[model samples]
Target: MQEMKAEIATKNSKKANLLDHNSLKHILDESVSEIVTSRGYAEDVRMSNVRLFIGTIIIVIALFAQFYKKKFPGNRDFLIGCIVLYIVFNVILQLISYTKEKNAIMFTYPPPGSVTSTGLVVSSKLPRFSDLYTLSIVSADPKSISAGKPVEFTKSVTQWFTKDGVLVEGLFWKDVGALIDDYAAVPKKKK
Candidate 1:
């Protein structure tokens, strides 16, 4: 309890700078495809998990229904019951996973919240980046949207990501440099 609070306090103490026009611009330019990839990745994961659950249910039904197979002889009330249970359970689990994924994406991006917090305008001036989208660095502060502050445009690199906010276990964005440098390094991957 206290330990966790102390850790969070320590994290909040770190300074995370705002991305400069070039760095932010780079992310903005590349993000059209990245958003597509992230969205698809989330969708794929959801589908795969649902498939796995379905496969497990099928196997369980097959195994259990067999023991009851001979008992019914001509009637298949047990087998029918198993199938019904599988479908009902699958629907429930699918809804749960869908809700979980939506929460994860919203927590990480918080587009609606970030825009209001940062005071960044999407007027005609910032042309290379689209007026349709908003880009923000994760804030060092847990309680507020700390991106787009003037201080962020300078050289500071301290940023904090609450794992709960990032929402997936063992995942976080460490800093603005990591954000820009990490993605920029990807083009060098081939040959």
Candidate 2:
């Protein structure tokens, strides 16, 4: 883990330039394609599951009602109730997913000099690994790179916090690049 972190911090050869804008762009693109997109896809699958579960429940209830010759106000009311439940549950899920997406893409930048810090749990390492790389992109000159915008990716446990509850500092190269590409407020110069 430390080795990987070091590689992210300093590339032994000139092959990987972590500091360059193009590298950042690459990281951001990979993040969107791998992390963010997967998260969105998972949410979609979850929504589909909700739909399937509701449909199954509704059918089971309708079948039972018919088999038992049960009547509630009218046969229509039973189906109507099931349909209402389906809509309500699906609506709630949609609202939750939407809220998450909104929160995830918060491209916030404080005053240039102001410190924007988040803690990360490092193994036996003092305090945390500073997410300097990610935060730096956000803090750099407006002309250099676009910072604080809603992250295109979902805020997962790995992305948001560590096992011990510390907020993970820094982002994977993929996340940094993807974020800049998708959410950078100022246009980045091609180097």
Candidate 3:
């Protein structure tokens, strides 16, 4: 884990040349893709499991109702109740999935100065819905990197996507890049 963190930090540091607006925008764009793809994929897998579990429970209840129909004359009422409950459960699941997709946050390492103990968090609102997303960066103490301790947040940066995960493609990048450049320019005290 430490090795991977070190490698990531090295790579980010190398890519800290925020003077080039194009490069910075490209990096942010790439990060958005990474965040969405990874988080979306995980959400897909989890929702699939939840759906399967719900289906299994519904089937088991149905089977029980069918097998005990003669012993329990109330089987018809019980089965109808189960069916209604199944429908309600399915609707609830759909709502849950939609909520998750809209609000899920994927944390990843940001370029240089954007680093934080919790790193960067990316989330989407889905283009068809509102075509917006929130990208939050929390600045951390450089010394925490070496100490393997949680860093303190000295600053924060928040950017939003105008269309899905894509930025407005103008001064936004410059503003964001300037902040990161300023942060990265800060000298760290040696432990």
Candidate 4:
């Protein structure tokens, strides 16, 4: 009986040791995974910040070039070159901005209703024209409107047009409303 008790105690001790070791290993693994995940997120945020900072600097430089062109109108070639370079830089910056924003939206928001040949169309409880315009700008493709026929603008090439809040009125609000209505009417498939 004494020998049997000793054997049982020894077995229990070994079992306890193994359980403790497994528990410790599990804790360590969880901690390491958390640290790795946090580091990855931090790196992503840092990269985004760097991109935004660089874009801002480029835009500022572009604005300075515009100012210089205005200050020296006689140098037409230099002015034109600066303007072209500025536009190119601006387009690059906008592209980067759009990509980042799209990624964020995709990650945070629910999946869009359906992705057509053009782009994603989201269904909303309340649809507004301003919202549609903003969406069009974000989507960056005028061809995304897959619904009703848009009112054909039949103005001459020389016709001057401006936004409502601007110095001159351009396209009518009714036209914009129609465009939005058409966009909202686009068919969407279930996810």
Which candidate leads in TM-score?
Answer: 3
* After superposition, candidate 3 runs with Cα above 4 Å error: 1-52, 55-74, 103-121, 125-191
RMSD of each: 17.3, 15.9, 13.7, 24.4
Candidate 2 regions with alpha-carbon error over 4 angstroms:
1-74, 103-191
Q: Which stretches of candidate 4 lie over 4 Å from their true place?
A: 1-43, 66-71, 103-191
- Per-residue lDDT of candidate 3, residues 94-157 (tens digit): 7766764344344344344433342333332322322233343332233466212221122111
* Candidate 1 residue runs with Cα over 4 Å from true position: 1-58, 66-68, 71-73, 103-191
* Maximum-lDDT candidate: 3
Q: Residues 1-191, candidate 4, lDDT per residue (tens digit)?
A: 99999788555431212223333333322332233233221112443576677778677767766676445757677767767777787787678766544422111111146343333222111122111112121232335553223222222211222221111112323343344445436556799
Task: Please give the distance, in angstroms, between residue 119's alpha carbon in candidate 3 and its true position after superposition.
Answer: 7.7
Residues 1-191, candidate 1, lDDT per residue (tens digit)? 99999789667542222333343334332432244234321112444466577778867876787766466756477779887887886786677656543212212232343233322211111233332223233222335544433222222111222323221111222233344333223233466
Candidate 3 residue 58 Cα shift, in angstroms, is 4.3
- lDDT for each of the candidates? 0.39, 0.39, 0.45, 0.38
